[model samples]
Target: MSNRKIKTFAPKGTRDFLPVQMFTRNKIINLIKKIFEKYGYEPLETPSIERLDVLTGKYGEEGDQLIFKILKRGTGLDKVGVELKEFTVTDYKDIIDLGLKYDLTVPLCRVIAMHKDKITFPFKRYQIQPVWRADKPQKGRYREFYQCDVDVAGSSSMLADFEIIYMVYEILKTLGFKNFLIRINNRKILNAILEHCKIEQNKSFFVLSAIDKLDKIGKKGVINELKKKNINEKVIDNLLEIILLEGTFEQKLNELGHIFKENKIGNEGIEELKEIFYYLSKTDIDSDFYSLDLSLSRGLEYYTGPIYESVVKEPKIGSLTGGGRYDKLIGMFLGEDVPATGTSLGIERIIDVMTELNMIPETKTITKVLITTFDENLKQESINTTWKIRNSGINAELFFEPLRLNKQLSYANKKGIPFVCIIGPDEKKQNKVKVKNMKTGEEKLIENNKIVEFIKSITD
Candidate 1:
């Protein structure tokens, strides 16, 4: 045999899903889609690959760095034998044109832009699809993963933000997430906080990115990161104090108002937060489930108003979900502003948390019953029995080979198929079939016509 062969290992940060994993993944996705649909969100899909320029400037500086760009075809990539050689290339602009989509929101904007005339205002959409990122993969992080995003466009009211928040609350509750908080903060408020701290604009993005990691790295670690960028130690200390402020959600908002009372942008943000909470208070939402975390500064540049993130209470891996209002994103492509609000369910993180907690539901085989032939001549009987069982709305599998009694029963048990139908000479003589309960190891001889009914009785 030729030694030339492909490598067996998957890429470093990607993984292959086995049968059990796929089942769980599908159930989660379907549940999310149903919730999205219930809220009047239509399904939308965009291509996995988009022009690099469209994704580059949209996700802020740190986010831009994590995009997986695609190189142009025929870029003079050298090759020798079975090994590939490094390209004699210099300019990124010349080599790269497309990139794997990093998130669903941007493409949603692009779609709205291209089809503005065809679509209605206040368009609601949900996209469940895989996105690629070139980040260091760790627990609950993947190079390629699915995001469940539901967004509504063309409405800037605080009501829009409130709806998004309510949707997120319901989603978490439905997903069996109990100890979770829907913490929200406004971009304008973050801007105001920076103004109070006297941090410069050029460094604000870097500052927000560093601060966003506060949950992962403690205050000291965040301070070290800020110091690397030459931010003054005093400024770092004050910034930490401002973002990490504590107390009741309302009381904290009052404190923020006092700090930025003279600052117009800050007061505007304060008023916005106040209005949101005032409206939220009128609803039946659990106060404990949704609240404010001033430190929750989502680092995305596009978020112009209310940034939201959902985090678990203990064993925090990262934000379980995140999104916000971006009033100007669609205008970049359509030349007209369309205000929108959204939330993205980080599916991989949810799965990881569920797996660690053993919350994934035990899923047995889809096939409810197994039909095995007693002998070579009984294959016809097996086929007929399998078809009848399936026709009666039961999942049934047939044994193609003539096997021993123990082997046939073992196959049924191994597959987790609860019922097995065996047709043999003695049963054929009596116009009956032997039904075995795989779970209880009990056998009963039933009339041939009642085989399907007998299985259904046990299953249903």
Candidate 2:
């Protein structure tokens, strides 16, 4: 065999999470699940690969570009070569019919479509899973990441929207995010402004998509992008005026009242939002967390109703979560309408913000003790000890390998295991074990029956 070859690495925009990273990730997932369960949302999961047609056009132009397409299996290579020589693949939509799901929302819409006859109305479900994005990785962005999504479908109730908003606030706050805000907006309100300004419907998506990045790229950048689409300065000024004028939500409603005088659709949207806040006001969760942000447009063609984006108040990261109401999305799939509202919390970003704020608890709670397997002779004793310690409600494990004592101890120390139990021929004969507290660099001999208490004391 050849001497060696350079080892390959994971594709760009993806990463391997070592022990510490996985620890924090699991912690965040658990916390989100707890909050989701507390609000009576059931859990559901779907396949990772979805038909390409089901996902396309739901996210608008830019979003469609980010879907990771999967090619046909087997001798498909022959067809690919022939097709490539003839022309670009853009014209043949059916050739590329499979893709890794870009987001959970689209597949979820498909699920609702197929199972509408079986699923109960007003279904509340939460899904935590990895999604693929064919975008360049940045400081806090990744190609593969987890989105903790909670959604309510089949109900047009504004109360569901309020409940989701409060759920986001409580979940983050409970996880020690003290400085944050849930920004709210309505797409109908945006549509009214565009129509009142005499802007065409086709041009409206381009304008809203540009404004959606205002938080990241600022107003000047948005104006530049809008101008590229041939939008005039007067309309731009009016758009900025509507976005900038801010006060209490009620005050903003009064302001919107003047703009919606001729646009009944806009008035209906404003009234729906008013009822959402009214219902929220009666809840125990603090209302201050939700803010009326006219500029907070979630850039998705599917969102025809209320939208939300959560941002950490202090300077740390970008929006930790964002979602909106997609009223007619199911209609596209089921040939019938279903009102749905959902939010996707960026799991990695939330953990990053928590770490920056020093909110992540460094617990010595993970395996506290490791009982080394000295010999096959004493394996049963070691296993019994591990179970006893575990049965006592302390995290403990038996070393699977029969490596050297020093190597085993080193491995235990590296894993932050504080106590290492040594059971050899001598200790087994004496009915006693040696407990080494790695953190304190101390060791003691304790009776076999008393080992659990000894480990507990060390950990405690």
Best candidate per TM-score, number? 1
Best by lDDT: 1
Query: Residue 191 of candidate 1: its Cα lDDT?
Result: 94
TM values, all candidates: 0.91, 0.90
* C-alpha-based local distance difference test score of model 2: 0.85
Supply candidate 2's per-residue lDDT for 191. Answer: 86
User: Mind giving the per-residue lDDT tens digits that candidate 2 earns over 194-251?
Assistant: 8887788889888887887777789999999999999999999988888777788999
TM-score of 2: 0.90
Q: What are the root-mean-square deviations of the candidates from the true structure over C-alphas?
A: 2.8, 2.8
Scored against the true structure, residue 21 in model 1 reaches a CA lDDT of 82
